[model samples]
Target chain A: MATAGTADSGSTVPTGTSSIRRMAPAEMPGSSSTTQSMKKTIGHRGVETTTGETTYKKTTSSALKGAIQLGIAHTVGSLSQKAERDVLMQDFVVVESIFFPSEGSNLTPAHHYSDFRFKTYAPIAFRYFREMFGIRPDDYLYSLCNEPLIELSNPGASGSIFYVSSDDEFIIKTVQHKEAEFLQKLLPGYFMNINQNKRTLLPKFYGLYCVQAGGKNIRIVVMNNLLPRIVPMHLKYDLKGSTYKRRASLKEREKAVPTYKDLDFIQDLPEGLLLEADNFNALCKTIQRDCLLLQSFKIMDYSLLMGIHNLDQASRERERGGAASGDRVVLEGPVTPDQRRPQAQKSLYCTAMESIQGGR
Target chain B: MATAGTADSGSTVPTGTSSIRRMAPAEMPGSSSTTQSMKKTIGHRGVETTTGETTYKKTTSSALKGAIQLGIAHTVGSLSQKAERDVLMQDFVVVESIFFPSEGSNLTPAHHYSDFRFKTYAPIAFRYFREMFGIRPDDYLYSLCNEPLIELSNPGASGSIFYVSSDDEFIIKTVQHKEAEFLQKLLPGYFMNINQNKRTLLPKFYGLYCVQAGGKNIRIVVMNNLLPRIVPMHLKYDLKGSTYKRRASLKEREKAVPTYKDLDFIQDLPEGLLLEADNFNALCKTIQRDCLLLQSFKIMDYSLLMGIHNLDQASRERERGGAASGDRVVLEGPVTPDQRRPQAQKSLYCTAMESIQGGR
Candidate 1:
């Protein structure tokens, strides 16, 4: 989400030297130093906006660095759901968030915050289902998500995308075309914005593309590949209330620490990852806050998702009346030949599936 | 997600030939028990597939549902992460298997021995997201989800519908072409097949229309006038880090359960919902399983997000080099305004915003 009150967080302005970390007892990673290091914290001037609100939302999301692991395809494989005994390879997507440190400069520790000061910026988090979705029946497909996608503050400047699977994966995003052009250029620009923060919070930019929409083009950024992973508590982890004692026992403390590798997502970290950089924990906090704390599945909030799904459901071609007896809903997308590496495609599917199983 | 092989669940068929419950659990003001107790469970009857491998894949996901909740969303919510302040929602279109139990033929569930057979059906379910969208840097915009949307799963059936949303509150679905033909010919046939399940698992049909794709006329499914509701979690029960004294002293949990006005979800839920559902204990188990579960983010994951952000960094005209942008995405949709209730969009926005702050 992007807007004036949102503090232009997508771009950070560097203060260039003064320390923002307070001198109180602090927990700086790796240093374990007795003296407080030059830790960085965000320094907000708190600008007022036309609505008389200081429009920056402060919700934090997980940083990009840890996401590859959360969304990669599972290493152990997927667990089957039936009383059947066959083991299977699960194809799923997974999502997670982290936050950059708040109030930081190039000189400080953290750099990004999930909360933006813009009305346009909705906190990027998710939660709940039937208990909530069923609460309002008339409002059902009013939105398209049982899970929340990232809410945007500014659809024009920044936004998120969504995809669905019926027979073939259908990618639907309400993101505008202009943004696509922006991504084609700005990816490298922003990568260079806060060199240290970028290094700490995410890997360097790789590839970006612009998608066309409504007679225009939108931006769809592609970065380092994310893998998908799953948390098969039945087969792995706490084991829930299963009759399988061995499985649950093997995962005691492991439950406290999520196992990141699986078919849905991978564990590939950014090269030269840091344990405690300025933006590292901030992104982690963002993941905890936006992706974790306040997430909820609401009935009418499908403006973003339904906007896309509705289009799909509404535009479906009739089944048998096409003057022919055998008609199939055929979609022609640019295909990647099998001879080439299909790594990216597989990784994305994994992340999305794992996410469906667990994330939001 | 569509194929597999495995041992049978060996669960006995249900006893006394009870139908599945399809209504909203009798909270719709005037619903009768007969309506409320429509088809409830799909005791898998081994759908008419000639292939056995496909059957195994479908059942596995169903069996695994009992294992665990995505506890990571909750644990991260409780963490001091930065993004924890707003409401978050995620969307997942999963390929899952559902059963359609036969109506009360003379045979009791006891007689069937469950046949241990479940008719394999693919429907989507939404898992709850906490307050935000997590970062899985490895994901791509068009990558992940892989499923197809058929205009009509059954052409000759009326009411042969499927549920699409997790909340089941907002959207109900059915095939559409010409309104007159759909109502007169298809609705009943479709409903008959779906009505077999009877639970609110499929979307209820609402209206009809046609869309143009590749110049062919495609019919759309009009779902009943239902809005997806927020999966509700009572605040009193969600006191995350309270001590025993704080927990006991808080009057929140002791207060009468709040009910939805026109909505029937939580309000319809028998009071003492958490206790009734045993979610408090369930919460503990979920928490223990998914903490620290994530790995780092990858570059490819943030591609779309970053790509768009980058696009905006430059003038659209500039990115296009003064030419028409190449990625022009055209969405031919329900040209006709969806003939559902007109909602006060702002009312929903308010509820959505507040939901973020109060949710877990």
Candidate 2:
């Protein structure tokens, strides 16, 4: 989740020699080749890079990525066995610290050291989530974590990187220490709220870990991908219901899959979607309760991430043998008419039916 | 789930000439040496063999066992990919059917050629269960299923064979077609009930598959073992809440680890467990709801499987270095005083806190 404070106040795209200078690797220590390649790759794919290494280095998750991944693998593998199955209970979430001492090698400096520690706040509470969300450790460890990680050109606020698991079942995002601590503090209450009310549009948090590497305290949290795993969203919006700087920059708008904000959303759909009486009341009640929960926690500036997938357009595009990209993308496999009955109606995202009453 | 139709009326322990007649493998055209070996191995482990070849062959799961196992592996593997992640929904759950054509045999009669087919019912339901119960398919298909299937002389009703997964996380049992059909009919209702209530003492059902092999239709259902995975139960009772012929026979009791029934439980625990007012009320409500669910389905003669693990006696026996017998059994690893707080309270079987009153 990106913070509102991190968004650029004045949008200016860096390019040419300035971009090349920003892409230099040796300037930063412990920078992965993947991130270097990602900037150039996304640039070629026609997405402008805003946050450079200088700003990114201040709050980097790169150093902690490998360590957190290993820690998760080790903890999950150990806990998966019969002897330690119950060890995943609420209090038993803290594992022994994993330390990688400085090797004292010729090229490497002695001051550099890496250590990782992970804690599961109310793991038993999250176990309920594991049941409902299907984010089991096996799915993460075997199906996704075991494969090579792919770092993407993140659409999130600057200085943050997002890594999608090979199977795209889970997302690992770098969070500032303040956000991590806030989540850790809010977890128990968040869990209680979720346990009581199962219908909410809030993001599902899975695991949290902190890494001490490259003289930076990088905090990371693992969460279930908010986007539908099977259905590709043709359009996405990050709406905060606020007017101040609530529009995507021109550079962000250049991306094939840019996240539009509240102004753009309002401009496109002047008359909001109309719902049946009962459904409208239920949605209002859910939103009210969610707002109360957030208010109780004194949390603010959080946005409601929304996605829309046009089924008919997706089907027609597939029928025409069009390349899957942006509007033409089809994430889930082909579904026969019979397969798209009541089951499709049950999906959370499909409930966001956009009945565009009038155009912008 | 045990059915009333399968319970035996008589108390005789079928053995001697009857046992020899029952063990006649040549009489059964589709009998396998593998099944024979399994019986012998389990017998050597000190369990008696009352359900021999004659009764077992009549309701054989042998032909379908191999086929079902392979089908599950194939299904889980194929569906484990990213494209199929959402296939595990509330409604969709069947995997691809596996078929094996009959082949002419050289060792036996050509007229006895048998074909096999297997299909898993609503695998998505089981996938949800896998997430909740923490039983990963990889652990089964790779770690346990790849190992040789070891058949055990089931303490269950006669002629029913039981197989424990190599890792002992799951149990596989063969059922008669009638029982299988009854369970299939009950599943939707059963699932709905479980979805609403989490504290019910009902056994968790995982998968149900029917195999047409060995010229016989063998129905198999996989379920989570009720007994604690790590802790040993010195005494186990399968109480049907009925008195008619409910006690184990003399020969059955002669075994080291016999499954005592209703009469045995009553005879031993004349004064039942005492509970606090709130706990007693909650328990009564749970039992009442459970019975109503069963009655609505017109189901009868189900058992409440119980196991007793005396903490103090077990500790004392271990301290004295006693031989591992019924009284001296130890299964749960060393329990520190600190660990005895929440875990001890949460155990499904640990309500054996009847040490408050005088014991037998």
Model 2, span A234-274: residue lDDT tens: 66666667978888778778976666777888887678554
B105-144 in candidate 2: lDDT tens per residue? 3321122225556567666556655544445556646543
DockQ of each: 0.04, 0.01
lDDT of 1 by residue, A230-310 (tens): 111111111111232222123322443232222212123225233344334454443333212112211110100000011
What tens digits encode model 1's per-residue C-alpha lDDT throughout B148-189? 122222211122223232322222232223332323232222
Error of 1 at A357 (Å): 26
How many backbone clashes are present in model 2? 1
- For model 2, the interface Cα RMSD in angstroms equals 13.5
* Candidate that scores best on DockQ: 1
lDDT of 2: 0.48
Worst 10 residues of 2 chain A by lDDT: A11-20
Chain A accuracy as TM-score for every candidate? 0.20, 0.67
Indicate the DockQ of the complex predicted as candidate 1. Answer: 0.04
